[model samples]
Target: MAKKKTNEPKTLKPEIAVGVLGSGSFATAIVKMLVENSKTVHWCVRNEFVKGAIELRHHNPTYLTSVSFAPKSIKVTTDINELVSQCEIIVLATPSIYLSDQMEKMTCEYRDKIFVSAIKGIVPKANDVVAHYLRDNFEIGFRNQAVIAGPCHAEEVAMERLSYLTIATVEDEVSEKLCQLFSSSFIKVEPSKDILGNEYSAILKNIYAIGAGIAGGLGYGDNFTAVFVSNAIREMEIFLEAIYEAPRDVNESAYLGDLLVTAYSLFSRNRNLGNLIGKGYTVKSAIQSMNMIAEGYYAADSIYRTSKEKGMKTPIIDTIYGILYEEKNAEKQFKKLTAKLT
Candidate 1:
């Protein structure tokens, strides 16, 4: 018995079929991007109504409604197996919390398919990132796995605003092909082999965005935010080095740029979640109010537990976990955080 060589490139034709799994704003945006390059995309919409709306109305009824699609270009279905069987490449855009259940619904094989994770949070109960979850549970190899990370937001993508995306995979050809598939006049695609670093950075940035939003909601001005973000990146660098130790640039768009956008952008759901909490809403209440999933809310506990077990001192992560999970006062937790930041 021999182990499979995961890096051996599989033949990806120029006319490869693509599928997007999820019906959220980001998923809608990704479908939009794919249609620009590929002829038809197999889309799995879990909600029958949303699937109907997309197929019949040519737009997502709930998210990114402004961006219309050609009905002929999208093959919309509620069945995950239907979509998986129809496509060679699958982009997972589901909320991390729902991912395991969604993956469980697939009865088809995934070993031959190329999976790109657009998810930025850890899987809740499993405490694994999407890439590892695919490997551990589905036996999908690293070469078959890729990640789509943003400094880019869905709203901006819908508006056709110029944005940057980093496509990361251990296999160079996989990363390059994805980059080619996803790039457009308004979208710039960069390639990287640092899949772990990029994915971890994507997850961590959302948690830090919550910290920024809390500061904003608490009436802290630009001066405090500037210092807070600066400290956040340093904290991110230390944590990544301690865990993965990859020779990667922390200042790249996939790292620092993603952090900046999530922390400061108006479209950030994680920041919005923190704002509600900072304005004195209970965690349960704030979560109930939003229609979207805030990755930071889930990532906080997962990162905290993992960091503690690994014996990494993450004061910012600790402060956020206390404020969110331990029921600590936001003002006091942030006050303590201020002392540790400089």
Candidate 2:
């Protein structure tokens, strides 16, 4: 069940110190945003070479090398505890699969700090969203938790292209402060109170994007792709409503806009994974080939289990799960899925 929103407001300072945990493309992009508004940003990068490169070269060596940073404005460290102790807010951008392991390494208590999940998938074994995971394990209350959702992509952020980010928290002050930290000339931040809805929408969209890629790889043209995505949004609405009944517009950018971009954008890693699978690569081979994580690959199973337990009807999720996890033929599953979609 979703936690009830509290009437008690949380306090946020004007000058906020931010820390980001993760060294991926999105993490690099987020650090870039922080540097624009912050004097110094604390970042946790476990990789020695990546840490050395960022400190010495003023750029991430592995991801998003094109976007350079002022080395003096950022503090790169190998210790999660050190970073956590130094910063007021910690943005968790690590892959959801690795979230547990990463949290286990934290020597400091996270209960007092604000945690924002930039990760969009459920934690693997726990089957809980990032917010719930923190709440259950670390006693981080919903009041102190927030989520960053996007119809936006890290690649576009790296290019300094215009993008929209939805920052969701039950506390208005927390959302506003995060918006101030992240908003730039090109990056527009919108505040939302629907944290769970937006987080689930963000997770569900990647699964739909994989379905879109499967269709594209199977030679289904724009006409079919359009129908697939339209039905996908409806399915996402049903799933979100079933899980957490909120007065949210599924048509909002955080929900519908996010689904559209992930399903159609060239930068979508989930779509790329499905495309490879559709073109005859086995799931193992497809996963092996990509350097970045295709979140949907992990999210599919988690969504499938949760929706099943909830007794919700999610045809799009079911179909994608069958193709990706059940090893069902992609062509056959999509054909069956077409009949279910309007």
lDDT of 2 by residue, 1-342 (tens): 988966533233356989999998888889988887888899998678889988889999988889998878899997899889998899998888877888898888667788999999989868888888888888888999999997888889999999999999998878878987998888899889998999999999999999899899888999999999998998899999998999999998899999999999999999999999888788889899999999998999999999999999999899989988898998888888888888
- Report the C-alpha lDDT of model 1 over 186-293, residue by residue, as the tens digit: 899988887788899999999999999999988889999999999999999988998789888899999999999999998999999999988998888988999999
Task: State the C-alpha lDDT per candidate.
Answer: 0.89, 0.89
Candidate 2: pairs in clash: none
lDDT score at residue 264, model 2, on the 0-100 scale:
93
Cα deviation at 127, candidate 1, in Å, is 1.6
Q: 139, model 1: CA deviation in Å? A: 0.9
Deviating ranges (above 4 Å) for candidate 1: 1-13
